[model samples]
Target: MRSAAMRDEPRVTDAEARRIAFAAFVGTALEWYDYFLYGTAASIVFNRLYFVSGDPVVATLAAFASFAVGFVARPIGAVIFGHVGDRRGRRASLIITVTMIGVVTALIGLLPDFAAIGVAAPILLTLLRVFQGIAVGGEWGGAVTLAVEHAPPERRGRYAALPQVGSPIGTLLSSGAFALVSLLPADAFDSWGWRLPFLAAIPLLFVALYLRRRIEESPLFTELLQQQERSSSPVVEVLRRSFGRVLVGLSASLLGVGGFYLLTTFAISYGTETLHLPRSLMLGATLVAAVVEIAILLAFGRLAERWGPGNVCVVGGVASALVAFPVFWLIDTKNPALVVLAITAGVACLSVPYAVAGSLLTELFPPQLRYSGVSIAFNLGGVVSGFVPFAATAVLAASGKQSWSVALLLVGLSVLTALGGAIGERLRIEDDVSAA
Candidate 1:
């Protein structure tokens, strides 16, 4: 009953699995570093440097709006790179995506400020952000797919979670870089210190490409190629055959992607502007939170082996919802210790679902279209997540700076994540039955 192509494919040894997983981790870390760097800058630097306005609030909103432009480009990136990943190979798509992000990010560092170039500065910045968004849109899905597909079925969850680790690592590195630079005097920081983090992306990119080039193509994808089973139009095929799965994956991904922005980006702005906390305090909180999330992700990856990734997601969602208000309360207190504790707890709770999202999403569609399916769903969720900071900022302003309204927003996102997990589990069961 087994096809020759499937049988002929080499089994993934534990060593090979680890190798691929490490490569995925490195690649994704680079991707997220570029992404999170922009986010950190948008909150603290870009509003002043690029989107200068008379009113601080107006300038911040404008900067965040430019940040949201990348999210809009994400779905487009998903479709384009997803097609390449699905039709060509995951390796090729990743190389292209990583290279694109590295170049664009470095360019941003060298870009002229608003004072130097007037409107052209912000316009170019937004364009670069769009390219960054597109590159990232493709990066995660391919990285996760390559890692998961290269592992044995029993180890898929652990390997899949490896790529997810890159997120917190990215957060850690980006936050740390910004934190270091934030130590500069105001005039110096506003002038040139902020560009260091973005410029650092160039070296990091080379390291990522080296690791990625060393890894082999996914065996599952190789099998597809050998069988001549690759879809000519993976995007169209996925949309037609598994549109519902895409919706489910989008919901499952909300808290990890969207809630992350709520907790970090928006919270950073909230801490600084409303509570009058120092920039160092907010960045420091994020650094601590990222460390906590790394541990939580590793632990949960193992837990997913026994409890199932879906179940873990459901639990994480509920826990995040319960802690949403508490997180805000702790931040509102303005005590540095409590603020760090609050962000750490929030990131830890939400990370439970995020840790295993890669494996869960990969299972949502067949290998033939896995790239497109995962990319579309995940990036579509990103599309919304990208705007979360802007929306939260707007909501907070409109509600007279009430933290409770923002908490309510987090609660709603958490609930949707839970619902998606439940639905995904049921669908997996149905799929198993059909296979049996």
Candidate 2:
């Protein structure tokens, strides 16, 4: 019933819709930049700096465990900020989330290493990661809701996908920053060069805040407010009424979140440590893959409008599954060109579903509960995804550093995503009929 009312809400001007999409893009990109910075650092620097252990493998695992810590806090952030978005407003929730992430990211930069402070160093780092997780848990849902709600119903696919581009943009920026710094002498790189990217978060935060401040509130959310139709407890309402949808949403979200870490974070670790490839080679591969992902996202956004977001996701998932083994095979060659091609192909294939996940997830719930619903489902998927790199790393180690085990993990995630897309398509069809 609420979906019907949302469809009837006045559409914003094209210029207004574009402006909102752009604003959402900027804020999301910055949030992801901060988030991905941590991931990249965990792979390249944190293990050595913070997670000092007798075994190199033990140190790497500990660093990734800290990386996973942020995922644990994501769902908590989702519930907290989801309530704020569904009640107070999307704008308010976004402002707070971005600020929290920026501050936490900058603090992570200044944090002392184990040599400087002992066990307390890692404990403090883990605490800051928790805050980062919380902030980002709220970020994606609100950004998508704000963009999609402001757009014409028929064009929501395009607008919704705009914010999704932030992932690759974030990947590109964070990886590019590290790639530049990785050029420093090994001792210098470890000492202070690594801190530069995290510290860069401070200025980027201000730019994001400025853009977010100027954007208009979501039109659909505004109507909910005027009608006094806001749910008193949106998180509970969503779960009680739409638990199944939430589950499907989580499935739909897995590849975009989990598959991403597999291709980038874990892959970087594998390439650098196991293959004895240069760190620059891994970082450069990631940068190239990110660029490819951005193009794929924009292209698939348009495709989602034509094919339906869910259907596009299904196709993407299938494609990712097909490419999974080949991606690993290429990386196993250990040739720089083949390795770059492997990462780019893997990232590009997975990006198709990721490109449309925002629109698909948005359509799964009504406007009144949209923020909470999307946040809970997506972040729940993130909770699982957070462990993906750690899991992939562990699997690789257990398999005697065989790349195929990690490839199989990607295949499994891809199939799950396909199933979610199929279910989501059925739900979307049912929704269209019900609205009619």
Find the candidate with the highest lDDT and give its number.
2
Q: In candidate 2, what are the lDDT values of residues 273-365, reduced to their tens digit?
A: 888899899999999999999889999998888888899999999999999999999999999999999999999999999999999999898
TM-score of 1: 0.97
| Cα error, candidate 2, residue 84 (Å) | 0.5
lDDT of each: 0.91, 0.92
Off by over 4 Å in 1: 1-10
RMSD per prediction, one decimal? 1.8, 0.9
Residue by residue across 1-436, what tens digits does model 1's lDDT show? 1223333445689898998999899899989999999999999999889999999899989989998999889999999999999888999999999999999999999999999999999999999999999999899999998998888877888899999999999999999999998989999898899999999989998998898888788888888998798889989988998899999999999999899989999899889978899999999999999999999988998888787788989999999999999999999999999999999999999999999899889888888888999999999999888899999999999999999999999999999999998898778767656655
Clashes of 2: 0
* CA displacement after TM-score superposition, residue 415 of candidate 2 (Å): 0.3
Error of 1 at 406 (Å): 0.4
TM-score to native of every candidate shown: 0.97, 0.99
